[model samples]
Target: MSTIFGIPTPALYGQILIGLINGSFYALLSLGLAVIFGLLRVINFAHGAQYMLGAFVAYLLLNYLGINYWLALIVAPLVVGAVAVVIERTMLSRLYGVDHLYGLLLTFGLALILEGAFRHWFGAAGQPYAAPSQLSGGVNLGFMFLPIYRGWVVVASLVICIGTWLLIEKTQLGAYLRAATENATLVQAFGVNVPLLLTLTYGLGAALAAFAGVLAAPIYQVSPLMGTNLIIVVFAVVVVGGMGSILGAIITGYVLGILEGLTKVFYPEASSIVIFVIMAIVLLVRPAGLFGREE
Candidate 1:
C-alpha cells in the first residue's frame, strides 16, 4: 500500500475531493464579496443573511410547494437576487453619498434582523434537503468510489467561476463596470444609468451567494445560523485574496480551502487558524494581495 506523508494515498485523495468541494463554495462566496466591494465600495454585511435565505427558500419550496431540487437551484438565486435589488433600490442606494461606515452598519443591521427573523420562525433548528435524483449516487473509480454529487459540485462551480472570470476580464460590459467604479459621475454623464448598474451588481452578488447556499443545502442542514459562521471564514478568504480582482479572489479561495483541508489531515488543531494565519502573512507581505495593484 502506497502512502503520501505517512497517510494512505487513498485517504489523502478523498480529503482532497472534499477540499475541492469546500473550495468551490469559498470561491463563489468570496467572488460575491469582491464584486460588491469593487463596484459599490461597500462591505456588504448582509451577504451571509442572503446565503441563509437561499437555503431556507429552497427548503420551503420543497416542503410547502412541489418545487423540486432542479428548479429550486434556479429559483433560489433569482429570489435572493430580487431581494438584494430591492434592498439596493430602497435603502442601500441612499448610502452611496454617505460614509462607507454607514453602508457597513446598515448592512450589518439588516443581517442581524434577517437572521433573527429566521431564527424566530425556524427556532434555530435545521432542515434537510435531499439531493436531486440525478446527483444522488456515486461512481466506482476502481481505486475509490466518488460521490456523483460531490464531483458535480466541484466541476459545476469551477465552470461557473471560470465563466465569471472570463466575463469580467474579457467582455466590454465588464469594462464599463470597472470604469464606473472609478468615476461613477463621469460614467453616468455618458448616459450609462449607473444606478441601474449598481442594483444589477448587487443582484449579481446576492445571486452568487445564493448559488453557494443552494449547492450546500443538500450537504448541510438548512439552518438560519449556517451562513453566520460560513461568512466569517469567507471574509477571511476575501481579506487574504484581496477584494481587488475577481480572478485573484476566486483563486485564493480554492487554494486556501485546499490548504485548510490538508492541514486537517496532518495537524487537525491548525485547520481552524490556518486561514487567519495566512491572512496575517498576506497582509504583511503584500498589502495589495498577490493580484491586487497598489492604490
Candidate 2:
C-alpha cells in the first residue's frame, strides 16, 4: 500500500469524500445563519433544533404517513419554516427594540425546549431513516468508492447554496432585503412591508436549516442530539467565514471540512478541535472574520 505522508492513499481519498459530505452540511447551515443574521441582526440559536425537527419530521412522514423521501424533502422544510414564522411573530418580534442579548437568550431557550421535548418523546438514541431507492448505490472512482447518496448531497448543497446566493445578491427581492437590512425604517417608508419581510426572512433561514437536516437524514442517525452536536462546529465555520457573509460562509465551510478531514488522516487526535483552533486564530488575527467587513 503506497502511503502519502505516512497515510495510505486510499484512506486519504476516503477522508476527503467524507469531508466533502460534511462540508455540504456546514455550508448549508452556516449559509442560513448568515442570511438571517445579515437581515434580522438576530443570532438564531434555535437553528439546530429546527434542523433536528426537519429530520424528525421526515422520519415521521415516512414511517407513519407513508410520505416518501422526495416529498419529505419539500414538506419538512416548509413545516419547520412555518413554525419559525410563528416564533418570530409571537416571540422574536418583540425583542427588536431591546438588547440583542435578549434575542439570543430567547432563541437559546427555544433551542433547549425543542431539544428537551424531542428527547422526552424519542429518547436519546438515534432512529433509522433509509435513503431513497434511487440513491442506494455507489460509484467506484478507481482509488475510492463514492456513495451515490453522499454525492447527491454534495451536488444538492452546491445547487442550493448557489441558488440562494443568486437570490440574495442578484434579484430585485434580494435588493429589497439588503436595503432593509441597512435601513428598515426608510425601506418601510417606501411602502415595503418590512415586518413581513422580516418574518419571511426568518422562515427562509429556518427552511434552509431544515433542508440541510433532510439532506443529512440518511447519512446520520435521526437523533434529538444530532443538531446540538453539530451546531457548535457550524457556528465556528460561520465565525471563521465572517458573520453575515453568505459567500464567506459557503467557502469557509467546504475549506474547513477538507482541513478537518486531512487532519483526521494525519493527526487524528486534533481532528475534532482543528476547526475551533482555526476559529480562535481567525478571531485573533481578524476580529471581523475572514470575509466580514469591519464596523
Candidate 3:
C-alpha cells in the first residue's frame, strides 16, 4: 500500500474525490448567489430553503406520484423556480430601492418559515432517496473506485457553470442583463422591462439552488436541515470568490473544495475551518473579495 505523506494512496484519492464532489455543490450554489446578488442586489437567504424544497419535492414526487428521478430532476426545479417567481413578484419586489439589509432579513424570515413548515410536516428525520438504477454502480479505476452518480454530479455541475458563464458573458440577453444591472432606468427607457428581468433573475437563481439539491438527494439524506448546514459554507465560498463574479465563484468553489480535501488528509482537525480561514485571509487582503471590484 503506497502512501502519500504517510496516508494510504486510496484514502488520499478518496478524500480528493469527495472534495471534488463537495466543490461541485459549492460551485452550483455559489453561482446562483452571485447571479442574484450581482444583479438584484438581494442576498437570498432563502436559497438554502429553496434547495431543501427541491429535494422534498423530488421525494414527494417519487414516493407519492410514482415520478422517477429523471422526471423529478426536470420538474422539481421548475416547480421551485416558479414558486420563487411568485415570491419575488408578491413580496421581494417591494424591497427594491430600500436597504439591502431589509432584503436579507426578509429572505431570512422566509427561510425560517419554510424550514419550520417542512419540519412540522416531515419531522426532523431524513428521508432516503435512492440513486437511479443506471447510476447505482461504481467503476473500479486502478487507483480508486469512482461512483457514477458522483462523477455525473461533477460533470453536470461543470456544464451548468460553464453554460451559465457563457450566457452571462457572451450572449445578447446577458448584455441586456448587465446593462439593466448597471442602469435600470436607462434600460427601462429603452423598453427592456427591468422589473421582469429582476424577477426572472431571482427565479433562475432559486432554480439553480433547487437543481443542486436534486443532485444531492441521493448522496445526503433529504432532510429539512440539509441545505441549512451547507449554506454557511457556501456563503464563505461566495465571500472568497467575490459575490458577483460568476467565473470567480465557479473557480473558487472547486479550489477551496480541493483545499479542504487536502486539509483532511494533512490535518484532520482543521478540515472544517479551512474554508473560513481562507475566507478570512481573503477578506483581510481584499475586502471586496478576490474578484469583486473595490467600492
From the highest TM-score down, the ranking of the candidates is 2, 3, 1
Worst window of 10 by summed lDDT in candidate 2: 238-247
- Model 3 TM-score is 0.98
TM-scores for every candidate against the unseen true structure = 0.96, 0.98, 0.98
lDDT of 1 by residue, 1-295 (tens): 7898899877887878777888888899899888888889898888999988988889999999979888888999999999999999999999998899899899999999999999999888888888999998999887777999988888878988898788777888787788898899999999898889899999999998888888889988899999878888988898888787899889998998898888888988988888889988999998877777788
Q: Residue-wise lDDT of candidate 3 within 93-177, one digit each (tens)?
A: 9999799999999999999999999999999999999999999999999999999999999998999999999999999889988
Which pairs clash (backbone N, Cα, C closer than 3 Å) in model 3? none
Better of 1 and 3 by lDDT: 3
Q: Tell how far residue 278 is off in model 3, in angstroms.
A: 0.9
Q: What tens-digit string does per-residue lDDT give for candidate 2 at 1-295?
A: 8889888898999999888888998999999998999888888889899999999999999999999999999999999999999999999999999988888889999999999999999999999999999999999988888889999999999999999999999999999999999999999999999999999999999999999999999999999999978988998998899875789899999999989998899899999999999999999999889999987
Q: How many clashes does the backbone of model 2 have?
A: 0
Alpha carbon RMSD to native, model 1: 1.3
Candidate 2's TM-score reads 0.98
What are the lDDT figures for the candidates, one per model?
0.88, 0.93, 0.92
Backbone N/Cα/C clashes per model: 0, 0, 0
